[model samples]
Target: MTSSAIIQNIPCTLVTGFLGAGKTTIINQLLATKPADVRWALLINEFGRIGIDGALLKGRQNDVEKPNTIAIREVSGGCICCTSQLPLQIALTRLLSEHRPQRLIIEPTGLAHPHELVKQLSAPHWQTSLSMQSVITVLSGLQWQQEKYRSHEGFQAHVQAADVVIINRYEQLDATCQQDLLTWIGTLNAQASIIWAAPNDASSELTVAQLSMQLNQPSASISKQRATQSSQSRISLTLPNHLLTNMPNAGNSAAMTMDDEPPYRYHDEQQGMLLAGWRLPSHWMFAADELQQWLLQLPNWQRIKGVVHTSDGWQQLNFTPDSLTITTTSAQIDSRIEVILLANTDNSHINSKVSKNERQPLIDWDVYDHELMALLAK
Candidate 1:
C-alpha cells in the first residue's frame, strides 16, 4: 500500500485476462461486494467499436443518479495497450482531476499484455496520479489440453505475466485434471499465487490462510531490480486468418459504412468486421458424451468459437485463443460459433483481401465438421 509522494490518490487495480476468462465477472463481483464508503471508476477497453461492456456496466448502475458513484469509460477500436494507452492516460487524468474516485478499476481487453500495460500506467508522470495495486490474470481449465492452444503465445504470456492467476470454471474440472493443472501451473509461473474461483463463489477462497506460501514476492523483487522498459514489446496489429477474411474487399462480408446498416452494423466501413466463426448444420447431433469427447480432443484455438447446429437444436462453442476453453452454450439457437475479432489490422491488407475474395479457407465447406476436425488436428 505504498502511496505516491506527490499525489495522495490510491493505486488502481489492472484486471487483465485472455478473452472470456471472466475478468469482467470478477470485477463485477468485486464492485458489488466492496464497501459502500469507497467509490469506483470503471474503464473498459474493447477491440471493436461497439462498447458492449460499458453498456453492461451502465445498465447495472440504473439506481445511481446521473454522474454518481460508478462511471464507465469505453475505449474502442484497438486493444488498450495497442492504440488506446494515451487515451487511457487522458481519461485517468480527467477522472483524477474531476471525480477523484476511491478506486480506479481498469479492465483491459482479454488479449492485452499486462506487463506492457502496467509499464505504461506506472510511467514517471502517472506515478503521482495512479499506482498499480495488482495485476490479476484468469485462466480456463480445459485450455492446456487443447493442442491448438497449448503453446499459444498470448495464453502463455497471460500466465507468465500475472501477479495472481485466477482459475475460472473450477467446478467443471475433475479432481485429477485440477491437480494436473496445478502441477502445470507450478512449472509455468511458480511465483504467481494460484486460486480456484467459480462464478457463484461470493468470496474467493484466497484467504490469508490460503495465501500463507507467499508465492509472488520473488517476482516482485525481481521486477523492482529491472528497468520497466525492458518488459515492453514492439506493438503491432496482425490479423488472424478469421479477421483477414472479413475485410471489406474480402467477400460477401465487406466493410459497410455506419450509415449503411442493412446487413449488419459494423464498427467501421473501412474495417467492416472480422468474426472468428464456424458454421455447422442442424442435422449433425452429438450426445453429451460425444460432445465432451469432441471438446477434449479439439485442437488449440484461442478466441475459437462458432455456431453449432445439432439434431437437438442450435448452440454455440467458445474457447480461448490459446485453446484453454471448450464450452457449449444453448442460449443462441443458430448453432454456429461466431466470435467477434477486432478491426485493428492494417486497413490496406483488409481492403485487398476483402475486395479480392482471396481469404476463403482452403478446406471445402460441404462436410465442414469433418473438414474442421481434420484441420484442427494439424
Candidate 2:
C-alpha cells in the first residue's frame, strides 16, 4: 500500500480488562495527554445499560484545546464480541467514517470475551482501512490474589491476548507477589510488553504516534494480531438511544429500555457475576458524608463506580479490592453508579440470615436499594 493509503487508514487499539481493573482510568489518562493535532475517537462498551462510562468520558474532549478532537460512542448493556457484535460494528464503522479520527481506542466491557472479540476485530474485511494496534489490558496487581480472576475465562483471555499489560497499582505488590505476577505472565507466553505502573503515575499514557504505526511494521503486530466481526452485514448506524438499550440479562429476561426518565436502574447476571447500576437525575444530589458512610458499609460487592452530583460537587467514586477513591469530576451529566458482585455469595449481605453454607445473591438488592435511595436528597 502507498504511504498515503496507510495514513488514510485509522489505527485502532483495544483496551480490555476485568471488572475494576482501571481500564477507564488509563484511557482517561491517555486522552489527557493526547497530541494537540491528532483526531481521535473512543468507543466504550459497558456491561450496564446506564452508560456510566460514556458519561464519565463526555467531558474529556474539553481536556483538549481542539474541539471535537475526541468523539465518543457507546454500545452499553452487552459484550461487543458476542451478543452486541452488530452494535459494536455499527458504532465502530460510524466512528471511523464520520469522525475520521487518526486513531481509535475501544474500551470493551471488562466482561467481554477478549479472544473472540479480537478475532472479530482482526477479520478480513478491515485489512485495508483499519490498522489495528496493541491490545492493552489494564490489570490491578491485586487481581491475582482472587481465585475468581485466576479461574475466570474472560479475565484469562484478556491478559493472554494483550500485547501490553499495564499492571496498575504495582507499587502495592511485594517482592514475592511481583515475581509471581511476572511468572504468571511468562506462563501465558503472551509476549506482551509489561508496563509496571503505579495507578497514580502519569507515565502510563498511550500515545498517538505509538498507536498509529502500520500493522505490518515489525513491532506493530499489535495490529496484525487483533480481529473483528463481518462488515457485510448492513452496518448503517446512528447513536440516538445509547443507554440501557441493549444491556444483557443473566437468565432469560429481556433487557429493559428506560425512557427519558430519572433514576433508571438495571441488573443482570451471567458467568457467576452480577452487575447492577443506577442512573439518577442531575438534580438528585446527595450529602457527601452520608454517601461515604453508606458506601463504606457495603463492602461485599466486587466493584463499585459512579459519579454523583453530591453536595460537595460532582464526585467520581471507584471501589475495588485493590483501591478506593472519591474525586471531583467536571463531567456534567446525571449521577450514576455501577456495582458488580460475584453471584455465588454465601450470604454476602450484611443483613443476611442465610445459613453459612447456603448461597444467596451477593447483596440483598431490596435492602441496599432502599438505603441508597434514602441517601438521595429529597
Candidate 3:
C-alpha cells in the first residue's frame, strides 16, 4: 500500500518565519478568531533548554472551550524543521492519537528553515497521517525589507517556501518601504497570497492549497548588503533553560515534556559534544519595568526570557534582537520582569563594556500605563 494509503490522516498547517517576524502574534490572532466549529492545537519550538514559550501559550487554553481549542507541545534545544524533525513527527502523532483535533498548527522557531521542514512532512510516515496543507510565513514588513534579512540564504529559503505570507507591522513602514516590500514579495513568490496587517485587521487566514508558488533570483548587491548588515546586528546568547523556569522566584507555571517516546538527545559529532536541557515548571511571570531595568545592567545580554509572578497574574518576558516584550493577557494586571539573555561580541561583563555616562532608572511603567489607559479611553 502507498504511504498515503497507510495512515490516511488529517492535515496540519505549518507557520514558519524568521526571527522577530511576529509568528506568535499571528498564531494568537488566528486562534482568537477561530470559528466555534473548528478545533485546533498549537505546537511551539524553542531554541533554549527551557520551554517558556510553551508555558505562555498555555494561558490561552483557559480562554477557549473546544476540547482541542489549543494544545501546546515544546520542541527545544533546536528547531523542529532543521534540527528536530523526529520530535515534530512524534508531537503530531500524539496530538492526533490523543486530542484528534480538527487542525494542528505548527509554529517553528525564528531560526527554523521551513523548506527543510515541509520536505520532512512529505516523508511516507508523516504523509500517511498528516497532509501538509499550507506553509504560512509571518513577516514584519520593516524588518523583512531590511538589508540584513532580505539577502540571507535562510531568509531566502523562508520566503521561497511559503504558500501564504502574512505581512505584519505594515503600519510601521513608510509608503516607499511598503511598496518596496510588495515588489520584493512579487519577485519572491508571485503566486503566494500577501495580506497586510495592523492591529485593527490582525485576524487573517488563508487555505494553503489555494495559493501560488513562485521564486526569482535575488540581486548580488542585495545579498552583499544583507551580509554586512547581518554581521553587524546579529547576537547570540545561551543559557540553561532551568534558570528561566525553575528559579525559586518563578511565577507562571505549567508542565511540559517532549512528545518523542525516548526523548531525543542532542550531540555534535564533529565536536564530540552533547547538549541537554533541564525541565522547568511551566509557571513563571515577569514585571515589565523591572525586567527592562535588569537588561540595562547586562553588558552582554542578547536574548532573555523568564517566568515571573507579577502583582496581577503570570507572564513571560522575552528579550532579544534589541527589544523586550511581555507576553501576557490584557485581562489581568500581571506585571513582573524576567527574561533570557543571548549575547554576541557585546557579551562582555567588563567595565569598558559599560558606558561611563551612567543612566537613569527606567520609569516607563507608569508612563506606559497612563498612555494605555488614555488610548483605551479614547
How do all the candidates rank in terms of TM-score, highest first?
2, 3, 1
lDDT of 2 by residue, 309-331 (tens): 88899998888777788889884
Q: Please say which candidate is ahead in TM-score: 1 or 2.
A: 2
lDDT against the true structure, each candidate: 0.52, 0.68, 0.52
Q: Number of backbone collisions per candidate, in order? A: 22, 13, 31
Off by over 4 Å in 1: 1-7, 64-67, 198-226, 230-264, 267-338, 341-378
* TM-score for each candidate, following the candidate numbering: 0.59, 0.78, 0.63
After TM-score superposition, what is the CA distance of residue 335 in candidate 1 from its true location, in Å?
21
Per-residue lDDT tens digits for candidate 3, residues 243-344, read: 444444323222122342111122211011112222222232334465456445654333455555444445556655536666554432222222222222
lDDT measured at residue 216 in model 2 versus the true structure, 0 to 100: 22
Q: Model 1 TM-score?
A: 0.59
